[model samples]
Target: MAASSEEFSVNANEAIRISLVQPGPNNRLITKHEFHPKFTYPIVGEAEQIFGYKGLEVELLFAAHDLRPHLQCSYVKKFDTVGTTSALDLNKTFGNFLPPTAFQQGFESEVLDDSKAAEWTPPGVCVKKYTRGGENFEVWAGSLLDMPMRTLVDNIQIFIVFFIEGGQFINLEEVDWTLDRWRVYLTYQKASKTPTPNASPYLFVGYATTYRFYKFQKPPKDHIPISFPPTETITPNTLPSRVRISQFLITPPYQSSGHGSALYQAIYDQVMADPTVLELTVEDPSEEFDKLRDMNDFDNLEPQFKAINLKIDTSPFASMDRGRLKRVPTARLLPLDQLQAIRSKNKIAGRQFARMVEMYLLAQIP
Candidate 1:
């Protein structure tokens, strides 16, 4: 039966309080324990309760260590406020060392009692006591001094569990806590709960990079090739110029939601706000040109490129329709819109040609 506080207190004093227990060969294994200073036990009552016998024959077992005879010890129970589990009073048998600074750091000692050695519990209270052994008569107040020397030797066990395996002592500061430094992680939060926070209007966060657009004084009149080298035939005229996104990830959690289009519009708006830029480059219908090819309208690719502002200053040749070869001069220039109308008369051919052109312009080249 669990003893009452008063009864346990009376019985606690009869037994010598030990904080540490050492067991096995070489005394390598040790258990750390705490005791309440005020708690003590009545010898006869404790023994009878332990054996579960009334007025029966009982004998105490003894052993020897370091030329000193080992005396019978009691299995004292300790308590903690946080939980109902009781710890053992093995402080004496183990003699484990607890650093004063560690105790002062208010680790386990954060729950110590002010009095009663046998009544000690986890978060055990600190107490001052005189050294028991001769020639080392000194007073100390920390739990480190209340245990046995062999117990201190077995601290390797405590080290393995509490630190190495249990991870009770972890360095949380070392963790990379921020998912995105300037950005934030976006969860598909329920619309009913709370509105999500918006990203900075000036900055954009992309899947892999961050950016902000820089305004230009004079935007080109037609499609501006954001890609390097304005002209394909490079003679150094298209000096390496830099173009940047207004702000990457300006709208996080964009998903397929119209937010992407809105963000794009915002970028356009920002550029438009600066009256100097009359035109800005954006993907156009030529993107669909890939699905058209292999028909009379196969030649529509070149014209589509021009219709979308990707003006082609190249030549076009006419194929022979009669046995008498007709020569059509090359280097012909035609507005893309005009050519598209001409090709549309042949529906199937027009579509096939459009697809071929779209693929060439939209698709990255090798």
Candidate 2:
């Protein structure tokens, strides 16, 4: 019986068919692509396996534009209980990951109604629109405090667990001030043929999120401290802030398609254009994202670096400093003040600026 039971087990990631679905002709849903989840341990269990089922397949579908979701669980057979063993409770297991609405009987109908997708322009303002490979794309961004943006993120939070290893959901009950720190950006493909014939052309591609944290500014050397009232309506935006790229995910189909670069540049452009933002930083980024950042950051700064003739001064004793001192101070070896001005002007974090310098120096070689 133990050996027989082994046949009923299935790997959670493999058994789940996750898709970004869109409407085809006549308002019929069609899968854009089917991809397996990168991680399911958060949704299922640490073991990431399901037992007491055969031919198990779980369908987790998201409406491409709005990310409204639908879940359908099906299997060929369930093992008979011997003592206490039985089929895995699919609903109870997935309920933790999906919104409660996904399990309701009529929930699937909400997504099947292609009318919503047709009329859906991405929520919030269209911050950017560009053409790539002859297809038009738009980037829409809004404060999460807004109901539409909040609702949109609530619908899509399930992707964080599927794609990011240790991703966790954002708490929805936070106060307004905390919610104001969050900004969500969604990327969509503008209608090529209408989303449905004669429908709005927006189609979901990928998204990123960001938040602002206080960036302390040091006062002048001769400045004196002054006390102020405890509460005088000092909003978070009033002070200098570091624009942090918190969560960035370009969906599977859009990855490696230059969409990542476009989205990243858009964020950087937005941050730099804002006078209140001190510098831009990223929360812990994945290996892939690090590469993306490095490539784009260099591209943005390279022209300025060349225009200013930025390069390392290899000659430490060119001014006879060896005879007067034990070592060359870093400030003298490189023009620190000038580099700081450039970095500040560009709103790049310090360490990122240093890395960009290295990349600049390497490019100067040969």
Candidate 3:
């Protein structure tokens, strides 16, 4: 008796698993995960099916600290080709989605090397270090012009596309000046247990990236043009710009805690601290991300909102006809000048500020 064609096909998402593994004495247990990719169409096909394989399992392991990648595939059995029908070449299939180094024969051993992986730390300056739920973590940031940072992102960029919906790759090949305008924020935590010899005791948490785009400022009507000497230094980092968080993710294991909020607040604090930064923004934020931003914004503005007392005046509503009022007098209900002042001082965009105002006003209801 022979089985049907459906018997030979497997779901690519369920079959593929990605794990962030730590350096051990040896690749003893082959860290296991049955995690699914958010999307598998890019790798296999629209159907997201792998044909000619039965009980397929693929593990894509990355170094816990540095994110060096290694991919391994196995299955109960691969069906033999029947003329035009052939079993998929799993490794070759995945190669399209991973960096070429991931397929290098000796890459797994190198990635598991604790001596180097332990020493590897998050790039850039440590912007914040705090603990939540008794777990310690730190967030560091670096410019994209950095070689090590660029290499780090290159290794993990594929995961961004895989985990984040509608995510795309960052063009590291951009010119130096342009690259300098980009920034990456990485979070890490020290190992809670013992460490290997001469190895780092830190593990990777997750990361976020930001791009600083130039912000134009209108000059005063009475201002005169002034020319600066060619010798004077001017760099993108020093220009008045709006920083937009391009991609953000807190790996599965570390999520559901306050880490995402902390990372976001860290970025906000860092960007706001920069005299050159005009404002902070996010590019195509997901719904989950929007909620996170809203939480942080609400908390951050609470004190400021309190000092000025952001209470909505109800005088306009008091005299409204019960059933005939066609419009709400927004101007009379809220102080536009006060809100605008707060928005400018806080460097929040108009739309976001308006949303926050709505949330604040609603909170005042008895």
Separate clash counts for every candidate: 61, 0, 1
Local distance difference test scores for all models: 0.26, 0.80, 0.78
Candidates' TM-scores?
Answer: 0.20, 0.90, 0.86
Candidate 2 on 273-334: residue-level lDDT in tens? 89998798988888888899999999988998887788777676776655665577878667
Query: Which candidate wins on TM-score?
Result: 2
TM-score of 1: 0.20
Candidate 3 Cα deviation (angstroms), residue 10: 1.2
Please give the range of 10 consecutive residues that has the lowest summed lDDT in model 1: 59-68
Residue lDDT tens for model 1, 1-366: 655444333232224332322222232322223222221122223332222112221111111010011223333332322135232333321233222222223222221221232221212121211221221111111122223322321222222111121112112234233221111111111111111121111111111111122223345779685754332221211222111221122112233433333333333333334343323232121221121112212343445554455434334433445553334432244355654554432222334445555554554344
- lDDT string, candidate 3, 1-366, tens digits: 666777889998898888876545545323422255777776778888899988998878877677778888889998878446899888788766677878778765565554565456777989999987787899999987787887789888877767787887786655455437778999888756634454456677889998877776666889875853332133467777788899999877777898899999999998778888878888999999999999999898878887888787877777888774548767777788887788877888778888898898788788
* Ordered list by TM-score, greatest first: 2, 3, 1
Global lDDT of model 3: 0.78
- Which has the better TM-score: candidate 1, or candidate 2? 2
Model 2 ranges off by over 4 Å: 4-6, 80-86, 112-116, 175-179, 198-200, 224-235, 318-326
lDDT of 1: 0.26
The candidate that achieves the highest lDDT relative to the unseen native structure: 2
